[model samples]
Target: MTSPTTPGVPPPVVDLDLGGRTALVTGAASGIGRACALRLAAAGAKVRAVDRDADGLETLAALGTEAGGAVEPQVLDLTDLDAAEAAAAGADILVNNAGLQLVRPIEAFPPDVFHTVLTVMLEAPFRLIRGALPHMYAQGWGRIVNISSVHGLRASAFKSAYVAAKHGLEGLSKTAALEGAPHGVTSVCVNPGYVRTPLVERQIADQAAAHSLPEDQVLADVLLKDSAVKRLVEPEEVAEAVLYLCTPQAAFITGTSIALDGGWTAH
Candidate 1:
């Protein structure tokens, strides 16, 4: 394992500063998106918190203000592709975190749900990235962080739409990284395994039904079964990784994924 401390350097510190930066975070009403918005704001960035949940955005903005961070709430449904693109313009940091999930086998999945999932998860990110790139290229500095999941890397039964969208996001992130590098922008994905968030909580019943297990057994028998950690990853943990990817120290680390999977992928 790599040593915790670098030779001749003090232990790492959380002193990242983004004083003059502006960040746009999608799905900022809750879960990983909410955490990322707060984390970026805490680092001194003016965060534009975008979501369809107006009340949740208001709550998040108030919490961010209490933490001495600037959080501007923007109510948006990502299905409006043009608006999603427009919302990303002029952002120094763009976090593509908005997503929806539907658990069903490919054959049984509704076409409409699959299309909606793809539009929100995959297409919105592309539009946001498209809108953010010009400013980034002109300024020659930017960060694009896609909040992907372990589903982006590994497939699970009964999650066809989610898995397909995530896999597409992984590819899109890489392409952005390659195209952004010369202009001093970095694009990367932060993949966490089954984060302890409202989204995951909502999926428990569906997972149980799919696996024919009890709802109480879903967490241990289905969700965490492949995870060596035996617990759901926290949204804050994933947020921390997203924050790190935006720092100067991580400038050269792009076109790759930082997995906070707790050894789920090891097997």
Candidate 2:
């Protein structure tokens, strides 16, 4: 990669800041959501971390303190409509990041798995966004960052449920953006390619079993095959994109899907 400006000159700048915002991040106990929470808190936002795992949320709060960020942990499941509404009670920024992945051929997929994935990735986001509408409308400003995946834009074999749910969530986000635009609210979905996390790490063994390959080979040959970067994307990288969207500079940006896929979707 090369800079477009003169080699000796500094590139143009974007002053991205998220100070004085109240944020609610779902699935914030770990992975990309936790990373976003930490980043926002560091940027001086009062972050409310929401997750089902109490222990993980506590750990995230500690990490925020360690980084000198303001964060409060909340334990609840977005799958419950009332809980979803209550979680976003006073949030100006919402990051709908909770998700689940299942690896199964379509014929082998059951309704339970499909419903579970859809509920988390699609329905939950919809419920929360709908719940937060009045609050944002009252304030006349907000940012809704839907954390989707590259799978939402593109698909691979044996990920039917997850892909479907993500695709739906992307559509939902677009519609939300269109409706929220005139009200000074903006919505965008950040789609990233394969990320190295505990959930993704769990997929190694599953991939190994499904493809009849060793775990190491699954990581090397399967997941990295179409990734131009040739490495698993860091959770913090996705968080950076989320942080960017939350800034005043991105106030004009909405209703678009941003791919942080490391060229996986470029071709």
**Candidate 2 stretches greater than 4 Å from native:** 1-13
Please, what are the lDDT tens digits per residue for candidate 1 over residues 32-79? 999999999999999999999999999999999999999999999999
Candidate 1 lDDT at 171 equals: 99
lDDT of 1: 0.93
For 148-221, candidate 2 gives per-residue lDDT tens digits of: 98888998898899899999989999999999998889999999988877779888887888899988899779
Candidate 1's C-alpha runs over 4 A off are 1-15
lDDT of 2: 0.88
Using all chains and alpha carbons, the TM-scores for the candidates as numbered come to 0.95, 0.93
- Candidate closest to the true structure, highest lDDT: 1
Candidate RMSDs in Å, in order, are 3.2, 4.7
Ten contiguous residues with the weakest lDDT in model 1: 6-15
Candidate 2, number of clashes: 0
